[model samples]
Target: MQKPSIPRGTRDFGPIQMAKRNYIFNTIRSVYEKYGFAQLETPTMENLSVLTGKYGDEGDQLLFKVLNSGDFLSKTEENDYQVGSKALLPKIAEKGLRYDLTVPFARYVVMHRNEISFPFKRYQIQPVWRADRPQKGRYREFYQCDADVVGTNSLICEAEIIAMINEVFNNLQLPDFTIKINNRKVLVGITEVIGATGKEADFCVAIDKLDKIGIEKVNEELIQRGFTQQNINKLKPVFEFEGSIVEKLQFLTTYFAQSETGLEGVKETQEILKYLDSYKLENDHLELDLTLARGLSYYTGTIFEVKANGVQIGSITGGGRYDNLTGVFGLKDVSGVGISFGVDRIYDVLEELDLYPAETGAQVQVMIVNFGSEMTASGLSLLQKLRTQGIRSEMYPDAVKMKKQMSYANNLNIPFVVLIGEDEMKSGDYTLKNMLDGEQAAYKINDLISKIKNSH
Candidate 1:
């Protein structure tokens, strides 16, 4: 028999991991609702046409396409196989696993345009797939908890997104974090000034990897992509400068004096920060990072990425403005800005820091200790009473040995155990055991409820 194994890039979450994941999801979902956003869900598989090209060239390459059902190759000829895989994909596959939530949301907006209100604010927490090589902090399948608002160009939305980012990390009890902010317009303006007009995509892509690959390799990549040495020289100062957000924007104002677009991007960044000045930040601070280019092709205005301080993992959350995303789906001029929380990476961070509460993993608060057949009959009535008052309680099946039942409760990390043997049943009192300290005491049914309820 062949040994069973899962795909290398995927993971199977056990009960504890599921509990932690739900904690993360519920935290994000509650915040989304508090901010007046409704929950939305889209199908796992979207049309190949809908999924393609929205992500840039490299992003498109990572898409996991689904093959057509029922003898998909029956109509293909020998000539069809001669064409390369890229060329022949359309012939065999008409659908694909969604790369991210934003693109599908765009498609949803266009299809339901007539039925919904403008500037629809919706939150989605679902799993998405990619075919890229996975490593630490990167997965083939992961969940993206995204909240977006469309149909408006208000900078208030941008400020609100920053506020949301702060609230999420704060609620998660995450340690110090930095929210890096940038503007795509600023990137375009820099390209125009440096004479790399047509290479904006390449410039953003290489710069986005700056922290990963370092400056030397990024310079080499620029040359290979047709950027002149002089262009790099002119662009060198943008990477070299460092200061406070206000100071950095001031420098950009002076540097982009000749470029109208660059100056506009700076003004927009300034305005967003201005709006954030009055709001009290909880756990994060925003920074102006010119090098923070989130290389997605759809981002048209402000771009954002968040990194957890003191942790070596990549951005735990990220998103930005997509002014033209809806246009491709036949809904013109509807702009949207949003961010996504990477739940898998966040889980890894929480685990590394040991931040999860002790009670988080253990679902049952109390377990009824089964003594024997006679004791089991009376235990059921008490068990239902405990459950009726909304305590998470369960009974071990099979009236087994005392040692075996105690071992079962310990394995589950159950905090409290109730004992109802023949003596307790006749006396009309129950013995409760504190699993952590192993102390047992007798109490009436009403007193048992009070003790368990107040224990936590």
Candidate 2:
């Protein structure tokens, strides 16, 4: 006999944990729905070709590949067995668990392009699998709550995304945070102006570690990554110039005035800022952050990352504009921008801050005590009545000790308990006890339902 266990990176959620998780998902879903984004779902496994090359090299390495069924290794040659996964993976793995919802979504749009309307806005809340090393606040299997608007390059969509982020965090009652906004084009423009356009990937990858590695160490990393002294000199201003976001933008506008792509990004950012102003989201809540480089290869325009102030968690959420993600799937010129809420990380933050509501548990508003066989029927009847009245009520399956049933209700944190012993059943009334304050009152079943409903 084998022991029962799950994969290391995966988690098994218990009832209480499920309740808390549902609170998070429902909060984000409600906000997504409010923004006119329809819900969507993609399969757990997608074709390897569909997922490959969408994320960066590092991300692709972390994807969980599924082995082909039915003698997967039967076709592998003896000589090919010694090679690395690069040469051997194709022979064994035909499918892969989805790395993220966004890539599968892009594939979805291309596959269903004809059936769907243009400028499609959709939201997906699904578990994605990764093969990364597990740690606190990092998992192999985690849920991503994503909302994206594709087929449109409108800045209004970007503003709406920011608004949706605000609404989600606000509804969750998360403490003050910053929704840092940047544009990938601006980073590209910086590389171009620095005469390192060919090394843009290396440059961005190095600077993306600015928070983890100091500026001097970043310059050293860039040098190690094959950047020239002249390019490093040009990049120094970005780190050295410290001021408000508007001042930094002013500097960028002056520096990259001639680059059309850079100027277009500026215009798009201006529109976003204008729309945000119309919505009045400016302040510490929404601000321009020049240092945000979302390391993903797909982002082409506006980029975003959110960080909570006074908390020590990583980016709680992030996403950006990708100009032509669907072009790889035979659809060209369709642009999209979206954000992903890192639900697990957010859960950690909320737990650390003690922000989760106390009442987050299974909704057993009332538990009916089971007496002997005679009162069991009465208790079941009362349970049905309470349920019919829109109250979440349950009863002990067996007629056990009164103390044992009450203990069960107490352990479950049920707010109220109903005693349906013989005396109460004969008197045509039920004893309703408030577990919180230990107050008891006797009332007819009808009046009891009404009182619970009205009081709640």
Cα lDDT listed for each candidate: 0.90, 0.86
What lDDT tens digits, residue by residue, belong to model 2 across residues 1-456?
Answer: 999999997889888888888999999999989888899999999999998888778778988999999999997988777787787889999899998999999999999999999889999999999999998768999999999999998889888888888888988888688898989888888888888877767776787788777888988988898889999897777667777767877888887876666667677888887787777754437767666787778999999899877887678899999988999999999999999999988888887888888888846888888787788888888888999999988988888788998899989989899887778967988999999899999999788998778754
- Alpha-carbon runs more than 4 Å astray in model 1: 282-284
Return the lDDT, model 2, position 345: 86
Candidate 2, which segments miss by more than 4 Å at Cα? 1-4, 282-284, 454-456
Models 1 onward score TM values of 0.98, 0.96
User: Which candidate achieves the best lDDT against the true structure?
Assistant: 1
Query: Tens digits of per-residue lDDT for model 1 on 124-176?
Result: 99999999799899999999999999999998889999998888888888868
Candidate 2, residue 17: lDDT = 81
Candidate 2: worst 10 consecutive residues by lDDT?
281-290
